[model samples]
Target: MPHHDGEQNGRGLSFAKRIYLPRTIGLSVGSVCVAVALYPLPWMHWIWAMLVMHAWVWPHLAYQRARRSSNPYKAELQNMLGDSFAGGIWVALMGFSALPSVAILAMMAMQNIAANGLRLLWQGLLANLLGAVLGFVLFTPQIQLASTPEEIYACLPLLVIYPAFIGWMGYKVALKLSEHKHVLSRLSRTDSLTGLINHGTWKDLLQVEFTRSQTLNRACCVALIDIDHFKTINDRYGHIVGDSVLKALSQALRDNIRASDLAGRYGGDELCVILPNTDLDLAVGILERLRQIVENQVDALLPELRISLSIGVAPYEQHIVDAASWLNEADKALYGAKSTGRNRVVSAPCTRADFQGLALGV
Candidate 1:
């Protein structure tokens, strides 16, 4: 789909050129054998003129026609029909020599399929048939029954080389498709601004970590982090500089987090981390370092502006019912940090009673 851009149908015209050129060469080469096996053309100049145009010139013509047309894809389809028509005409002129005629028709059908699959193949087949009728009218119907050794020898190159060429083309296209799929998969999970896992992907991982901790009976902490006075930063320095701050913070997260830890852009200026096999004290220590990292940083682009973070640490407890509750506890701790003073880490109390004292103690 990426290849198909700029006025939809125009998208695959280059693709059409790829289809056109090789088939043209193969058919042109095959024609020598067909001509020898059948009648020597009385219209020698005419035949050679058509052959040269098809072999040497048609690919460029087809590309230009498609590129210049309002509907390039549709124009290219017409070109494919032209190919089938020419193939049929050649078959008739060769008086239907069995091997050569069948070879030409089969190659036409394959070219049709490569351009637009079975439906287009059927259309090209009809075009070939119509051209055969025209050729019969113009040149008279005749069928050759035998091929000489020389004629057969001439056909050998096309038979051997053409199919191998098509197969190699197919292999390369498949590799490109695989690479595109990998890029799409990465983009779907990543935040464009921070280059961190997006909120939805991070939330999905949070649920998984929560379940893993419950099942394995391991300690884990979830931290919710928010940039302090982010709106003020945006207002004073504008969004471009604010974006730089987010990028810098993302770089810090990338640098500080261990392989086992997962950090993500939760939403806007908020970030979240899932630290498995880590308890409240360790989580607090990690968040404190991160808070320091954010606070001490000055924008490389706007050196006068500085940034800080309010972070909340909540360890998994036996009483926690679900992932949402665990995240809510961390959010409450984050709120505590923000409300008390920015640029600090607050750990949520295990129970409701200890909250006022312990949370504020941060």
Candidate 2:
């Protein structure tokens, strides 16, 4: 199941990358437009065209950044506001240089309103609208001082619409990018089979828990659980039956464990459970109940088949500094339980002297 999830997560990341590439291209184009607008040339018409193009492309850049950052809505909002603010500042700097492009700006704003949801569109529209009004108030007088009414009228539309249009575009792009990145992130952390954390994820979580335990001086227990006679069942009943058994056992473990507990499949026939702030005794009691649940549930799928689990538990101590060392101790106890006879729980020997006499290798 973990393997299956890994495959899905890989695919999701691939898809996200595909979506991101186009947004990057769009941002590059917007950057080019900004450069062109800043250049000194007798290219007012061309500058207006580039400004409109920039407005069209700007929203997507924010969207893509937000997706990569894993916060789509906030990214979109930032993109929208950023574009409007940039446009307002650009007009102010260029002496209201591109005020005649309001129609194009309004069109871009409308596109944003349509592409994003109605609520987002409304928010974007309101923001851009304020920006548009502000740009006109701040720049039109400058236009009056430097150019004729016809020239000012020609530039007025660009000033009024560009800020709002760019703002809306930026937001729309950010949302799409964020959604893609979020899906990829979720796929990476989740196991394919049972929608639980994978082995790697479990290890990472254990390390974190270990650190917390050490810092707070809290007790933590690690349990190594093995499905009894799993190989014999797989050989006799087929791999499909083996898979069913694994799934059934996993569900039972999840159902019986607390929300704070971390349960993950370690490999083919082994599962590990990390119980935070739990002592050896508490962990033993939980595993015993889990063993009974597994035994009872196995009968529902294969009545003739008798399945059981052997559990070994080890409590984290001040002396046990590393997660690996703690896991090894639990594993030794697990092996002891299996060797003594399966379907039993064994607690780890606490003292070094106790372990020295036993030939237990985890």
What's the lDDT for all of these models? 0.81, 0.67
Clashing pairs in 1: none
Candidate 2 lowest-lDDT run of ten:
99-108
Candidate 1, residue 87: how far the Cα is off, in Å: 0.4
Model 1 misplaced regions, further than 4 Å: 1-6, 9-12, 32-45, 146-153, 277-282, 300-304, 317-319, 348-353, 358-362
Per-candidate total of colliding backbone pairs: 0, 20
> How well does candidate 2 match the true structure in TM-score terms?
0.56
- Positional deviation of 77 in candidate 1, in angstroms? 1.0
Error of 2 at 232 (Å): 0.9
In the order shown, the candidates' Cα RMSDs to the true structure are: 3.6, 12.9
Models 1 onward score TM values of 0.85, 0.56
